[model samples]
Target: MNPNDPKTITDAEWRERLTAEQFHILREAGTERAFTGKYDKFYEDGEYMCAACGTRLFISAAKYNSGCGWPAFTKPADDETVEEHRDTSFGMIRTEVTCGKCGSHLGHVFPDGPPEEGGLRYCINSGALEFVADGDE
Candidate 1:
């Protein structure tokens, strides 16, 4: 899906479309516990898309093991695929990352990443993503 032309899904539709855990994370901006997300340790050749809207966000090449208990990507598939906002929750300032297409909370981005790899860590929640393996479709 194009991030520029986001779909307008309603709350009722979202609740029905997603699982409880997925709804919590994508719709209510809730987070899954560290080390418990499905994609934290998943490494494969594929693309990661927003779980809610299926917008392409990250590719396997940009993913790395950051030991951050979440899927980490050095960069997005496209600059406009994700959106960032200043988050001041829990007494900490963070850059929250969301799917630009559906405006669903994906995770947060941090500055402490491999300097050789764009110097950014996009710490994303697995519950917020759906992976499409290379050659799968």
Candidate 2:
């Protein structure tokens, strides 16, 4: 496996790198409790990146207070920033979002977003993201 590539990293390696909560949310496709995420109320100007692979996923400009108990975004950094999969887990049809580069589970996307901004809410997990405040890196 390429040490520099997230896509090639083994599960053991990922376990070594991520915390238990992060592993559960990112690797196991688990969901964090609503309103418990650090970024849920965080509004710093920055970019949200994939925690495992450091791939830029969302920008602060696209983020909004959707009151959904999680960090909500109008869109990704780009069309290829994240991938959406039809999730049927737990008997509910939802769209699962994942990091485009490493395929780490980010969260889910819902269609009940503000209609003005393309009407899509990218409800993402804070554990799946690392906020890089503007001018910090």
Candidate 3:
């Protein structure tokens, strides 16, 4: 690992950097209850960043009303910003999305998105993201 890599951050340090909810969702791969997230119904122009490592993940324009009870995006701002892995947890087979910089769990991706937007939905947890509204950069 590289020096000062976010992935190398210790749990104790993370506790100091994030709230209990954020640590649970980002580090423990926990999910917030559907429709309870702050960003679920948020619609503004800007970027969504990883709550843990602050890595830019999605753009506001990609957001859509998937009615999945969480914030949904058509695509990531950049494919390299996130990493996908085969997740078989909770007795289900799914693709888990993680932060490329720190390996924090964001959420899962599904193939049932809007067809005009390539048919992929990045179902993310609100606790896993921080929204930076447009012009607030």
| Candidate topping lDDT | 3
Model 2 ranges with Cα > 4 A deviation: 1-3
Ranking according to lDDT, highest score first: 3, 2, 1
What is the C-alpha local distance difference test score of each model?
0.92, 0.95, 0.96
Which RMSD values do the candidates have, in order? 2.6, 1.0, 0.9
TM-score of candidate 3 on Cα atoms, chains taken together: 0.97
Quote the positional error of residue 87 for candidate 3 in Å. 0.4
Which scores better on lDDT, 1 or 3? 3
All candidates: TM-score: 0.94, 0.96, 0.97
Q: Could you give candidate 3's per-residue lDDT for residues 25-100 as a string of tens digits?
A: 9999999999999999999999999999889999999999999999999999997999999999989999999999
User: Model 2: how far is 114 from its true place, Å?
Assistant: 1.2
Tens digit of per-residue lDDT, candidate 2, span 43-118: 9999999998899999999999999998999999989999999999999999999999999999999998889999
Model 1: residues with Cα > 4 Å off, grouped in runs: 1-7
Task: Please give, for residues 1-137, the per-residue lDDT of candidate 1 as tens digits.
Answer: 44345456778888988999999999888999999999999999999999998999999999999999999999999989999999999999999999987899999999998999979999999999999999986
lDDT of 1 at 118: 77
Q: Whole-model lDDT for model 2 versus the true structure?
A: 0.95
Check candidate 2 and list the clashing pairs: none
